[model samples]
Target chain A: MSTLQGAGVHGAASWRITRILSLRWIVWGAAAIFFLNLLGVIAVVIANSFATHWFGSWLPAGWTLKYYAQSWQNYQLSGILVVTLQVAFAAVIVSLLIGTPAAYALARRNFPGKRLMMLAFLLPIMVPPITYGIPLATLLYKLHLGGTLTGVVIANLVPPVPFVILVMTPFIEQIDPRIEAAARMCGAKTWQVFLRVLAPLLVPGLLAAALLVLIQTVALFELTFLVSGPGSQTLVVALYYAVFASGIRPAQAISAMAVIYMLTTLVVLVVTLRYVRPTQMVGTVR
Target chain B: MTLSETPVASEAIAGPERRSLRHRLADRGVDRLLLLSLPASLFVLVFFIYPSIYGVVLSFRPLKPVGAFGNYTHFFGDPFLRGSIVNTFRIALPAAIFNVLAAIPLAVVMRGAVKGQRIINTILVIPISLGTVLVADGLLNYLGPNGWFNRVLMAAGLIGHPLQLLHNQWGVMLSLVITGFPFAFLLTLSYISGIDPKMESAAATLGAGPWRQFWHVTLPLLVPGLAITFCLSFVLAFSVFPSATMLGNPNGDSHVLAVAAANTAFQQYDFPMASTISVIAAAIELLVIGAVLGLRSRFYAGTTTGKG
Candidate 1:
C-alpha cells in the first residue's frame, strides 16, 4: 500500500491526501477562531464602553454616552491630549531636523565605523525600550529635565530618531544623486542643494518618517510612563493612571478611555499602513 | 550681438572658475554632511548609551558588602524578588515557543488565495498596535468571571464553574500570544513567500505525498527563518510587564522581574538593586540572543550566501 516509487504526490488518492486537505481546513478553522477572538474582544470593550448596564446577559442591558462624557470630565483628557501632541510633535520635528541630513550622509557615503554606527542606531529599536528607560529617566532627573514635558520628549526621542534614520536612509539612497551634482555645478551650496534639489523629492519620505515617529511616540508607554510626572503625562500614561489610581470606578468609564486611546492610535495607524507595510518598517523578512 | 557675444566669451573664461568652484564645494561638502550624524549620535550616546552604561555600573555598586554582590544579594535575598526571575521565564518561555509554532501552520494555511486574506492580515496586525496595556484591559473583561467568554460557555453548558482565567499565569501567556502571534506570523509569511513555489510542486510531481513534500523540502529551507522569528518572539515575551500586572497576580504568582525592577527604582528608591535587576534582565536576554544566533549560523551555514 505504501511504496517509495508511488510515495510521491502523483499517487493522488491515498488516505494521506484526504487527511492533508482536512488538516488544511483545520488550520483555517483555527485561524478563523483567532481572528474572531481578536475582533470579539474588541467588540466587547467597545460595547461595554457605551453600555449603561451590562449585567448577567449576553449583551448589555442598555447603552448610553454617559460614560464617555464622565470619562472626559473625570479624567481630564483634554490636557493629556495636549501633552501627547506636544511630545509626539516635538519628537517628530527634532528627529527630522537631525535624522534626515544624517540619513543622507549615511546613504551616500562610505565611512569607517559606518556599520558600527548603524548598529548603534539599530540597538534602541531592536532591544526593549524598558531596558534603557530606567537610566534615561534617572539621567533626565539628574539634568533637571526629568518629570517635565521636556524630559518625556527627550526619553521618547531615543527610539524613533533611530527609526526615522532607518526609514529615511533607504529613501535617500533611492534618489538620483546626479541632480544634486547638477545643482552644485550651477553654484548651489550644500544647504541650497539639499533644500532646492533633494528636499522636494524627499517630501513624501519625510512625511512618512514623521508620521511613523508620531504614532510610535503616542503609543510608546514604557518610556513615557517611566519619565512622566503628574502634570506632564501623555494620553497613554494618563490612561494607565486613570485605570489604576482609584477605587470604586465604573468599568464603562475605563472602557471609554480605552476606546479613545484605541481610536486615536487606529486613525494614525490606518494612515501609516497606507504608506508602508509592517515588513518595510523592520526590513524585508524575505 | 554684444549680449550674445559677451555672454559666450565670459562663459569660456569662467569655465575654469566653475570647475574649480565645484571641486572646492564637493571637497568641503562631505565633511559638512558627515557632521549631520553627530547630533543624532550624540543624542543616542548621551541619552541612550550613557544611561544604560550608568545603570549597569550603578548595579555593580556595593550593597553592604555582605554577599557575593550587594545589589544582587539584596535582590535575590527576598523570595518574592527571586521568584520574579523564575516567573518571567515561566511566562516568556511557553509564550514564545507556542506563538512561533502556532504561526507556522496558520502561515502555510493562509498562503494560498483565501477569501479575505487582506482583511485577515489587517486584523492580525491590529493587536500589535493595541499595545500591552489596552490588550490587558480588554483581556480583563473577556477572561474575567462574568465576561462574555464565560457567559457563552455557561450558556452552552460546556462547563459548570467559571474559570479563574485572569490574574494568573494563563492570562499573561495568552496576552503575550495575542501580541506576539501577529508579529511571528508576519515574519513567517514573508519568509515562506521567499521560497521557490516550484520546488514544492516538483516534489509533488515526483510522487512524494504532501506530508513528505513539506517535511523533506519546505521544512528544511524554513529553519533559518524560524530561528529568527523564534528569537524575536523571545525578546518580545521576555519584556512582558504591563500585561503581567493587568492580567496576573501583581505581587503573587505572576510577579515578573520587570515589575520588581520598576519597584526597586521607583517605589523603593533602591537604585542599586534596581540597576542590578536591569542588568540581569539585559544579560539574560543577550544570552538567549547569542544562543539563537549561534544556531542560526549552523542552520544557515550552507543555506545562505552573500550575508557573510
Candidate 2:
C-alpha cells in the first residue's frame, strides 16, 4: 500500500507538470511557426547565394561560393557600398547640426508656441513618407535640385531631423539648466555656457541621435528613389535595378550585398544597445 | 579671464538704464533665434509646402500648355482608375486584418516568460530592415517554379506539378504579410508588455481559467495598442509598390494608388493625373490617421480615469 501511494503521488505531480508543459509547448509551437515564416525568406536567400545548383530538392545538391563571387565581380557591390556610406554620413551630420539646438530649445524653454513647435517636429513621423516624397520631388524638379545628391540628402532631412529631435528631447530635459545659469552668473557668455556646459552632458544623446539618423539614412528608399537620378544611385536603388533591371543572377549578388548591409546594421544596433539606454532617456523626460 | 578690480562704472549706471539694456539683450537673443530658424523654415516652405500646393494645383489643371480641370475630369471618367481604388482596399484591408489578428497571438507568446525571447525577437525584426526589393527577391526564389516548397510537396506526393505562388494577387499578399507582420508584431508586443501582470494573476486567483483570464483581463487593455498597430500596418500595406510590381501582375489588376501615381507621372508623363491621385492618397491617409489619433485620446481618457 505504501509503494502504491508513492507511485500515485509521483503520477499526480507528473500529470500537473505535463499539463503546464503542454501549454508551453502549444504556445511555443505556434510561435516557432510564425518565426520560421518570418525568417524563412532570409534563409532561402542565403541558401540560394551559396547553392551551386538546387532546384527540385529540399536542400541544395551542392554548395559553393561561386554565385556570390560571380555576383561581386559583375555588380560592383563595393562601389554601391561607398555611395551608401557617403550619403548616410552626410545626412547624419546635417541632421545633427540642425536638430541639436532645436531639441535643446524645446526641452529647456517654456515659451509660447512650444506645443505647436513640438507638433511640427512630430508630424513627419506620423505622416507617410510617400505623401511627402511625391510633392517634394516635384518641388525639387522645379528648383533644379532633382537628380542631385544634395536633393536626396535634403529630402532625407525631413524624417531624420524629426527623429533626432524626438530622441534627443528626453535626454536634453534631464540636464539641469542651473549649471548653465551658474556659468552665466560666473560671467560666461551664452554661447560659452552652451558649448562648455550643456553640450558635454548631451554627448550620449547626440551619439544616439547620430547613429539613428545614420541607420535611417541608409535604410531610406522612397525619398532617394524619387529624387536620385542615375548618377546619384544608392545601394537600395541599385538593388531595385538589379532585381528588376537585371535578372535573377545579378539580383542574388545584390541580395549578398544586402546581407553585408544588414551586418553593418547589426554592428550599429549592438553599439547603440551597449552605449545608449533608451529607457534612461525616456525616464528623464517623465 | 581674471576679474578686473576696477569698479566698472556700476555706480554711474542707474537701475532703470541697466534694466532696459538687459531687456534689449533678451530681445536681441530672441530675434537671433528666430533669424536662425529662417533658413530651415524657408527650405521647408519652398520645398515641402510649395510642392504640396503645386500637387493640388496640378491635379486641377490639364496636361496641355493651357490649364483646365480636364485631368480631374479625365480621371473620374476612367473606369480603370476607379477599379484601382477598389483593388487597393481589397488588398490592403484583408492584409491589415490578417496581420493584426496574427500579431495578437504572436505578441502574447512573445510577452510570456519564454526561453530565447530575445533571439526570437531579433529574428522577427530581421525582415523589417530588409525592405521590399530584397524580400521580393527572396520570395521569387522560394515561391517561383522549381522552388523549395514545390520540391518538398512533390517528394511528399502532395502534388505532381509546381504551385503558381507568384505573379498573382496571392503572391503580392504573401509578400506584404511577410514584410508587414514584423511591424505589427513588435508594436503589439510593446503595448501588451506594458500591461500589469498582476491583473492576469488576480483573475486566475478569482477562479478564472487561462482563456477566461486572457479575455477578461488582457484583451480589453490591449485595444489602444491594437488600434494603433492596425492603422499603421494598414497604411503600410496600402501603399504597396515594389512587391506588387515585382511579384504580381501590375498591368492594372495589382496597380495600387502609389503604383498608379507612378504610372501616370513617370511612365505616361501625365503629371496632372498623377498629382491628383497622390493628393487623394495623402488626403485619405491624413483622415484615417486623424481618426486613429482621436480614438487613442478617447481610450486613454476612459481607461486612465482622466489622470493622464
Global local distance difference test of model 1: 0.83
lDDT of 1 by residue, A1-286 (tens): 3453375655546656667778988988888787777777788889999999987677899989999999988888888888988998999999998888789889988776788999988888888877777877878888999899899999989988888889889899999988889999999998898788888999999988887787778888999988999889988887777666635578899899999999988988888888766644334322
Clashing pairs in 1: A8-B207, A8-B208, A9-B207, A9-B208
Candidates in order have lDDT scores of: 0.83, 0.72
Query: TM-scores, in order shown?
Result: 0.89, 0.83
Per-candidate clashes come to: 4, 0
**Best of the candidates, DockQ:** 1
Residue B253 miss distance in model 2 (angstroms): 2.8
Model 2 lDDT per residue over B214-260, tens place: 77678878877788888888888888878888888787678788878
Chain A only, candidate 1, TM-score: 0.90
Displacement of residue B242 (Cα, Å) in model 2 is: 1.4
CA deviation > 4 Å runs, candidate 1: A1-17, A281-286, B1-30, B62-68, B112-115, B202-208, B302-308
Q: Give the alpha carbon lDDT tens digit for every residue of B1-308 in model 1.
A: 88889989998989989888866766655455688789889988998889999998878785566644877777678888888889999999999999989989887777766677766777777788768888888888898888877877888899898888998999999899898889898888878877787878887898877788777777777888888888888888988888887888878878887888788789978777777888888888999989998988886776544222
Q: Which candidate is the best by TM-score?
A: 1
